[model samples]
Target: MTVNVLVPSSLSREAEDKREATRKLGYVARAATIFRADRLIVYPDRDGETGRFDDGFVSTVLRYAATPPYLRNEAWGMRDELEYVGVLPPLRAVSQTGSESNGSGSTRQGIVTEVGPEGRVRVNCGLQHPISLNTPPSMEVAEGERVTVRISSRRPVRAKLVDGPLPGLSVERTDLSTALGREDAGVCIASSRHGAELTVGRLETLAGRVDRDGMTVAFGAPERGLPEILGIEASDVVAAYDAADVDDRVDVEPTDLGFDLWLNTVPNQGSKVVRTEEALFATLAPLSLQE
Candidate 1:
């Protein structure tokens, strides 16, 4: 099932400096990657943003964190792709691909350097040098196109082209409505302290829904929660679904941000506040347990 994690562009509002901001964003990326989230979306929160924190900087650091170290230079080679900040850390995620049965070959992403006669093409698959592989007869590849390669062995370099999308954390910048409105977005959940408490039975039901529909979990900024970010009152969000009339439900969602549910993942909290990165880990931990 597809899983999308949403964080506000003002996520680094609490950071003391760019270096600290980069480090904090590293934890966010790490949390997403660890939870196996397909997409990490940064939504607009300009009002809540700090003067020192830059949305572009946040995206740059997140993109770098998502990319594998070996492919960083190639995938983000263009100078315009990212403005160099130099302080972003290498946030490497542990692979979920454990030693399992069936011996399915490992897959690696490669960039097509050149296309030759008889469908032969040169690919740079994070190796010491580029390797030439034949494209599937049905598939027509071109130069500068990204391709997936299935590697059966590394020593002898036995590999083949696998016609599919490249695998990794994808970073994006967009608005909340646009993100939730995507066709791939199934169940949209907004996390908030004022939301409904998530219990065992509730989680199971949500997991089943996630398994069927895919999910988009949205997180708020440090000081400004989603209600504030969306220009609404906390009480309105808490009682959004409490309205008796179906027609009146529109009032609850003024921004037309279609969220299936607003959830309080951490029910009994001792602390007065939860940081954005802390909230990400806390919320995704239970969701990951779902089917």
Candidate 2:
């Protein structure tokens, strides 16, 4: 099943400086990678965004964090591609294709540019040239689709389209409504302190839905929770999210947009507040659990 995690553009709004902001975003990226999220979307929270946090800074840092160390220079060589300058931890992505055999080959994320006759497809696998590779008889690919291509050799361009996960998570910057409305967005969940407390039984049921239809989990920015970001009061959020019951979609419209569920992933907290990164791990832990 596909899993998408959403973080607000003001994710680092609570940071005191750029160094702290970059560090905070690094943890967010780590959480997404650890959860095996297919996509990490940066939704706009313009009103809640602080002056220190730039509009596209969050996405830029995340994109940088997701890139492999070796490929970062090649993929993000341009000056504009580099955003935050703080040190970032390495995200050693686990390749779906088995481990490299003596370093002769490596897995690379690619985009399909053209699907030609006789199962030949042109793919841009970060190489100097977009190479044409043959697809497996059972596999079907379309132009403009992102894919994982295993390149055994670069000189002669020997590669094949393999069935596996992308080397690293992909990043996207978009608005909340637009992201949730995507065709593959599946079940969209909003996490907030004012939402219903997630119990064991409720989590088990939710996990089933996530496995079946895939899932998109959205997180709020620092200090400002989703309720505030969406211009909904905390009291109304509690009433709307809780009273909506266990229906596939929450009927009460807390904000202009709708979500399948508004969940309080952290229930009885000793601390008065739970940070976004903490919430991400706490929320995804039970939700991503296997039966």
Candidate 3:
């Protein structure tokens, strides 16, 4: 008999041991439903068995559901007993393509000849440089240099050229950029209070992942987009329902992200405030899943 095992989802993505282990559990059917298990307000079995698990012997067990933090529901919420998923990716910039024959195709390649803070770049291309052409960087060029550029065509009089300025032929400019170093870098914001502080920075990841725009930050632990990282819901923490309390995600924004966390009940009573710049690492230091 293949008995169905309904594991608590609160620890699914939180505790590392459970995250991987839960993923391995092949659920025949998966979903959350409110039922009666020991009169507990948990996502019990189809029969509302919240605790009584009977394989051979009867025993009591806790059940947690997968409620994302951002989800809004009364009760059915927890502070720290949450499961986690991977971090979300950054948003990509939208762009279009067009060419004389149709599209720029793969016929364009550029080197960063010059650049500025706001993603402005002066590039040298393979548009037949050092020939009867135009260079945008306004720098000196050598003969027979490989360059290509988007030329201005009007009056049916096409001006054919490489890329660099000829002995005397002048060129035009375009706002087109070659490469924007990293949009996920140099973003700075902070939130603080009394003496505790936290700051969120938009920077590059070692794996070359872009998180500038979609990069979430927090002042308090729960603010760093905890609902996104942890599968805890507002409904979980409310006494009207039953759920375990959980911790805040490390990178959450500590402002008014909302929570019944230890902080909210303790040092951070009745406050949805924000401000920061102190030993953030100290507050976030001991929070590792190493144990």
Candidate 4:
């Protein structure tokens, strides 16, 4: 199933400095990686953005974080937003063969270094050297584009460019409504403390639905919850959830954000506020369970 994870551009609003902000986004990346999210979308929250770290900074760091370590230097040469990228945590996502394999071979993320004659391209995919591969008959690729390479063996470096989804996370920037309206956006959920408390019974039902339909989960900024970011009242979210509990068919028109559910993954908390990164772990831990 496709799992899409969305976070606001102002996710680092509570961070004190660039280092702290970069570090904070690291955990967000970590959460997505751990949960095997297909996409990491950064939705705009201009009003909540603060300091020098805006949407561009957030997207840049996230994209950089998602890049494989070996290709990072060539993928993103030098950028102002990555000045403090040293503080970002290592994702160590499974990008190569060994534990993870596909069919007869293994799929890995690769960057096209050069496009040669006869529809062949040289790709750098963490191999000893860049390997020349023929582009798939139906696919067209250009230099600097990222592609997936299926490797059958590494001793002689036998690999081929295949039209397949890249392993690990992919970063993109878009508005919230557009993300929620995507065809693969399954059961869209908005995370908020003021929403319905996720009970065991509710989780079981939610899990089943998510497993069948896939899911697109959206999160807010550090201090700004979904209600504030979406320009809705917290009470309205609570009321919508309460109404849904009574009747599952009840449409949550009060929020008008198009989310199927406004969920409080962490019901009772000891802290006054839960950081967005922390909330990711708490929320995804249960939602990503396999049946």
Candidate 5:
């Protein structure tokens, strides 16, 4: 097999472009005074609330802002309290790998509660909030597949696979009825400009939201009081073979409204094209700002 390599020009251009994008993002967020150069950047929030310099806004913009499954940490999507939502007590979700949790007398095998939008399925052996999987095992459980779920307090109870026979871990089932209750991926309208999702590579790479539900984000919205305002545009992505990183160099694609971004630095681990605009923006808040 033959493999093509990245030319020096391409590599340098990508590096410089990435650097400029990140720098611009920092200036827009931290700079007390806005400048003409910023008009071209993809500011996560347009409310003109300017957050901080050494803060997370800058990182979020230049990095993962749209990626999925990660927590939203904002209040806009926090629909209700843990109790009001009628969640069963934290039941431990165990996997067939003997991965049982303690205090988890929560490990109970039960019928699926209900499956909702996307790949979400809700099982109720009487538990509150879904016991999120650190790596949600494949949702191979059939509607009637005997399964065991481990319950845990202080955290969402996880459901494990038991008595059922299946393949690998993936929630993609044409028979939507296979899994329990599930919610559609949450998206923050505020961060939509960076595209539907941003890949930060690690959990700590991005800032945590004040209220993490499932979807919806605040960006710089909390500073203003309209925590969950709507009316943002979203774009469909062409998934590229690569992803951009904090310092990745790569190519840019244009979309009808928002543009597409691609990164090649993290070779092979390459990802599909991502939807982004302006390539970068200043998310930095002034160093004096508090969290």
Candidate 6:
């Protein structure tokens, strides 16, 4: 099943400096990686953005953090947004492609260094040197494109171009409406302090649904909750959940933006405000539990 995590483009508006902003985004990336999220979407929140770090800054740092260490230099090169990237933490996420190895071989993320004749391409898969491999007849690739390579033997580097998604999380930028309307967007949930308080029974039911259909969770930036970002009053969110509780209906429309549920994942939160990165861990932990 697919798990999509969404964060506002103003995610780092509360950071004190670029270093802090980049570091904060690093933890967000770490959260997505830890949860095995298929997509890390940055939805536009232009009105909520502040300071120097805008949507572009947020997306660039997130994309850079998601890149594998072996291919980072070649893939991203240099950019001003990554000036404080060294402060970012490392995300040692495992490669999903190797789950079905079964002794056949291991899969590694590779970058296409060059395209050659006869449908061949030179790929750098973190070996001592780039290797030339014939691209599959059905597949077409270009230089600088990331691909997956299955390595059978490292001694002679016996490997072949494989059709599969790259390891780890991928970053994307889009508007909230488009994200929620995706075909794979099973259950769309908005995280907010003014929403329904999560209970044991509710979690059990939500887990079952998430396991069966998948989930797309959206989070707001610091100092700006979903109610504020979406222009919906906090009272409306509370009333919607209150109404849902009266009747056993899950199809409550708190807002016209198409979110199935507005959830207060951290009920009775001690702090006055929970950072977006912190909320990611608190929220996804329970939702990711499988039976």
Point out where model 6 deviates above 4 Å.
96-105, 243-257
Model 5 Cα displacement at 117 (Å)? 35
Instruction: Kindly give the stretch of ten consecutive residues in candidate 4 with the minimal lDDT sum.
Output: 246-255
Report the error of model 2 at residue 106, Å. 7.8
lDDT of each: 0.77, 0.76, 0.23, 0.85, 0.27, 0.86
- Give stretches of model 5 more than 4 Å off: 1-94, 98-104, 108-170, 174-184, 188-206, 209-211, 215-291
RMSD values, in order shown: 4.6, 5.7, 23.7, 2.3, 21.6, 2.5
lDDT of 1 by residue, 204-257 (tens): 667766777788999999889998998888887767534312222212232234
lDDT of 4 by residue, 146-186 (tens): 99988888776789988978877989999999999999988
lDDT of 2 by residue, 1-291 (tens): 888899898888888877778887888888887888989999898887887676677788788888655445545656542555446656666642235511356777777778899989888766678888888876778886667777787667678888776667889998888888877777778888778888876776676667777888999987889888888788877667665555444232333347877888888888998888889998888889865
lDDT, candidate 6, 1-291, per-residue tens: 899999999999988899999999999999998988999999999998895899999999999998878788999998999999898888876763234431357777889999999999999987889999999877899999999888888776799998877766889999998999999998788888887888887777677678878999999988889889989888888766665551344333434556778788899889998889999999999989986
Error of 1 at 271 (Å): 2.0
How far residue 254's Cα lies from its native spot in candidate 2, in Å, is 11
List TM-scores for all candidates, in order: 0.83, 0.77, 0.17, 0.93, 0.20, 0.92
User: What are the runs in model 2 whose C-alpha is more than 4 Å off?
Assistant: 78-86, 96-106, 110-148, 152-158, 161-167, 247-257
lDDT of 3 at 41: 14
lDDT of 6 at 243: 53
* Candidate 5 overall lDDT versus native: 0.27
Worst 10 residues of 5 by lDDT: 1-10
Say what the RMSD of model 1 is: 4.6
The alpha-carbon lDDT assigned to residue 117 of candidate 6 equals: 96
Q: Which candidate is the best by TM-score?
A: 4
